[model samples]
Target: MSAPDTNLEKQERRHKPSMIALRLVIAFAVLALVGFVALQMLGSGDPIAEELETGSAPSAAVD
Candidate 1:
């Protein structure tokens, strides 16, 4: 078991998001879906959809 050591090619990350950003995205998506479902179940005509659709949740972008 040996790795290739002959003229290794350089690999660059281009336009890639960070791990924290990815986790935030997934967490937000799940939370939005869960909130929407909960809203539908309550039958109070709440405006949870507004928050989800308007991207009001806390999130940040990493460089």
Candidate 2:
């Protein structure tokens, strides 16, 4: 009778990320970036709204 190999312990397992999980992450990131840019660019058709402004303005004088 032939003997079976007992070296299965020496074999390494390949690591891989779940495709579904990765797809979800990529989708979410892309959607978030698109939404952010759209909000900033289009201003949601409200010129005075959705404009999260930054920086300082000149001080007005009061006499």
Candidate 3:
């Protein structure tokens, strides 16, 4: 009985580090995906140029 319990404990200990590493990889992947999406949203510079081309600049002098 004690031998079986020790074997089970050893198996669990062996697998723990691998489980932790897998969780870390998944977390990093999610963070990278979020950062990619954020960059896509924030790095868009073409719309401002389009607005400028359309002459949509606000006037400084108020009549």
Best TM-score goes to which candidate? 3
Best by lDDT: 3
Residue 60 shift from truth in candidate 3, angstroms: 29
Off by over 4 Å in 1: 1-17, 44-63
Model 3 has an lDDT value of 0.83
Runs off by more than 4 Å, candidate 3: 1-7, 45-63
Q: Write the number of the candidate with greater TM-score, choosing between 1 and 2.
A: 1
Tens digit of per-residue lDDT, candidate 1, span 1-63: 776654333322332456568899999999999999998787755456656767796354557
**TM-scores across all candidates?**
0.43, 0.42, 0.56
lDDT of 2 by residue, 1-57 (tens): 765855544432221346567898999999999999988786566433434353344
Error of 3 at 48 (Å): 10
Q: Model 1 compared with the native: what TM-score?
A: 0.43
Candidate 2 worst ten-residue window by lDDT: 8-17
Worst lDDT 10-window in candidate 1? 7-16
**Clashing residue pairs, backbone N/CA/C < 3 A, model 1:** none
